[model samples]
Target: MAAGAPRIFVSHLAGVAVFDPNGDQVARVRDLVVMLRVGRRPPRLLGLVAEVATRRRIFLPMTRVTGIQSGQVLTTGVLNVRRFEQRPTERLVFGELLDRRVTLTETGEEVTVLDLSVQQLPARRDWEIDRVFVRKGRGGAFRRSKGETLTVEWSAVTGFSLEEHGQGAENLLATFEQLRPADLANVLHHLSAKRRAEVAAALDDDRLADVLEELPEDDQIEILGKLAEERAADVLEAMDPDDAADLLGELPEQDKERLLSLMKPADAADMRRLMAYEEHTAGGLMTTEPIVLRPDATVADALARIRNPDLSPAHAAQIYVCRPPDETPTGKYLGTVHFQRLLRDPPYTLVGSIIDDDLQPLAPDAALPVVAGFFATYDMVAAPVVDESGSLLGAVTVDDVLDHMLPDDWRETEYDLDGTDDGTDGTADDRRDGTADEGTDERADDGTDGEVRADGA
Candidate 1:
C-alpha cells in the first residue's frame, strides 16, 4: 500500500452494520462488490451487498455510502431492496477474493491470498484494494510453504483478475474449505444448485460425508447422486454407519445395491447389518462405533479411550464391558459402566466390578417409543443395543434419538436458520411400530451397570 494510505482490512468492512445519516441501521454488509478491469488495473469497487431483516439481501451503491469506518458504514441515501445479483463483470470480495491463488509480481511464484486491505481514494468517491496478505506459494501436491508470509500492494498480484464465465468459482470452494463441515453445509444449502454442486465436488470424501450428515435426507441424496458412483461409495463409507444406512434406505433398491457393491467388503457388511433394522427401531438409530472393552479393562484404559476428542459427547458417556473385545460384535455383552464410574473408581479398578445393570438393554427391534420411553424413564444419554445372541452391537446416542423424536420433516420447519427449534409442533407420519414413536427416525440411550452410572442412560 502507498505510504500511510487510509486502509481497512476487507474482513473488517465485511459484516459491518450500515446506517443512514439519520442514524437508522439499514442492513449488514454481507460482501463487497468489485468489477474486474483490464490488465494491470486493480478490480474496482462496485457497491456493498447488505442483508436486512425479513431475510432479504439488497444492494447499497458505493456512491450512497457517506462514510466508512470500523464497525460502521454510513449511507447518504436509500438502500434499494432489490436482491443483489452478480453481473457478468462483478465479483464478491469474500466469496470470490479471499483464499484465492494469486501470483506475486515480485517472486513470480503463486501464493495464497489470505486477506486484502481496501483503501478509499483521496477523492473519497472510490475504493481500491491496497495491501495483500499472502502465505507461501503453491508447490508439491497442494502443499504450501510453511511459515512463509508476505504483505504487498494489490498491484503486485494477478488471479481472479479477469471477468470470465467461471472466474472465482474454484476460489469460492477454497474459501469454504476453511469453514467447519456444518458451516460449509449451511453455505452450500443457501447457494444456487449449480454452485452447490460445484462446491460439493471440490470437497474430499470425509468432509463431504460430514457435511452430508448435517443436511436433510433429500439434500443428502441429491448431492450424492451428482457424484461418481465410486466417489459416492467412498463418501458413504466415511459417514457414520447409521447415517449412511439411513440415506441408503431412501434410495431405490437397485440404486442401493449398486452403491453397496462399490463399497469395500467390510463397509458393505456393516451397511447391510445397519440397513436390516426398521427405520424406527433402536437398531436403526445406533452407531456401531461405541466404546466396547473386555471386562478385565481398567478404569484408566476406559478413561483413555473416552479422551479421544473425536468421540461424540453421547458415545463417550458410557463403556460397554464385554467378554471379548472385538467391537464389531462386542462379544457376550456382559454389562455397561457409565463414565461417572470411571471417575469415581480407582484407576486400577476393573470395569467388570462397576458394571451397572439397572436398566435393560434394548433389543435391535425395539420400537422408537420404547427407546424414547427408555430414555425418559431412566433419564439417560446413551444405551447399549444387544442382539438375541447376546452380542453387543452398538449404542443409541441421545442426539440421534432426539433428532428422530422430532418430526420427519423437521428441517422444513420455520424455526431458526441455525437449526434451533421454535417450540412449534409438526405433522407426523404413519408407519406405527407398536409404540407412539412410529414413523420418526429418532434414536435413544439407555441403561448402565453401576449406581453412579456414566448416566448416559
Candidate 2:
C-alpha cells in the first residue's frame, strides 16, 4: 500500500496471523472490532484488534499496523506480548453474580470478572464491550479451580486487534465482567422490553434488587412479573423499602398480594404503609429511612450518621434539620442541609445556619401533577417527600418523572427524522395545486417577446 493511501478492505482479516516486526506471530485477528467515535460524529475507527492466545484479545493501535495484505497483515512496532491478558467471555447465568470469573491479565496478577456486559451505545449499530471490572471474587470455577485472578479495567484496553476465532462465526463477541446495578439498569433501558426482561431474569435476587431499584417503575413491574413469585419476594426484601413499595404499587392486584404475602412480615408492613399513600403524594413518595439528627447533635455526629447504610440514598443527600427520635417532627422541620455543603462548611456553624430555607419539599397526598410541576419549576433533580406532619419520606428524582412526562413512543420518535419534511412542499399534487408554494421562477428577459400595441387609443 502507498504511503497515506487509504487501506482497502483486505479480505475480512479474521483468523489472520498478526506478526510483529520480528516475524513472530504475536496474536491472531479475532474480529475486526471497530470503535465508533462518540458524540456529534458518526462511527469512526478507534483502532484494530488481534486476539493473542489466552483470555484477552490484544489491542493493536491503528497507527501501528503498517500494512494489510494477503494471508497475513503486518504490525510495525515490535510487539510486547505481556501487555494484554486473555480470558473466557463473561456470561450471565440465572441465580448467579456477574463478577464470579476471576481471570489472569497480562499485568495484574488476577482480577475479578464482574460482568459479561454488552452496550450498544447511542448513534452506533455495533455493541461496544464497555467495561471490565475486577472488584472482588465470590464464587465460580476459580473458587475450586487452581489459578490466580487479576483485574483489567475498561481503561486498560489499549486497542482491539482483530482475529478469526473460528471458520464461520457469524457474530463478534467480546467477553466482559459484570456490571454494577446502575450500569445494568442503564443498559437494560437501552434494550427492548422483552430483552430487558430476559436480562433481568438472569440476575439473582440481590442483583435483581440492585437492578430493579435503578429501573423505572414500569420496567420494574414488568421484570418482577417475569420472575417466579418466590424469587420476586426475595428481591423485594433486598430492595430499599421505598423502592420495593414503588414496584409493588405497579404490580397487578393479584400478583402484588401474592408477593407481599410472601415478603417478610416486617418488610411487608413497611411496604404496605408506604403503598397506602398516593403514588405522587409525599406519603407515597417518601422514603421511611432518613438519617435523623437532633438539633443538638454536632456536625461531626451528623456526618457520621450520614454514612449509615440504614439511611436511604435520598436521605443521605439531604440531612434533615429536625428534632431527632420523635416520629412527630414539629413544624420544626425548619430546613435542609446538603451533605456536601455540610462537609465543606464550617463545622461550628449551627445546623440552623446550614439549613437551606429554600429546600423544596412535597407533602404526602400532594397531587402528582403538582409535584411534577414543582420539579420543573425548581429545576430539581430530587426533592424530599414529606407527610402532613412534615415528617421525612422518600425523595423523587427528575428521572422518576421522565416516563410520566414523555409519551409512550417518545424514544422511537425522538431520533426519527425519516418522515420529516425536507423544507419542501408536501407532495407533487400539493405543489401543483399551489397548496405548497414553489418559488416563483421569473423568465429571463431576452426582450424577444416585446410587442408594441399601436396607440390607437
Per-residue lDDT for 220-336 in model 2, tens only?
777888778888899999897767888887777898898999999978888998899766565665556555556665677777777876544545776666754434333346666
Which residue runs does candidate 1 get wrong by more than 4 Å? 1-6, 9-91, 97-115, 120-179, 407-457
- For model 2, how big is the CA root-mean-square deviation? 18.6
The Cα error of candidate 2 at residue 297, in Å, is 2.1
Judged by TM-score, which candidate is best?
1
Model 1 lDDT tens row, 323-350:
8756667779988899988999999999
User: TM-score of every model?
Assistant: 0.67, 0.49
The model with the greatest lDDT is 1
Where model 2 places Cα greater than 4 Å from the true spot, the runs are 1-183, 186-204, 214-219, 226-228, 305-315, 326-332, 348-353, 357-360, 376-379, 408-457
Please give the RMSD of candidate 1 to the true structure. 14.3
The TM-score obtained by model 2 is: 0.49
lDDT of each: 0.72, 0.51
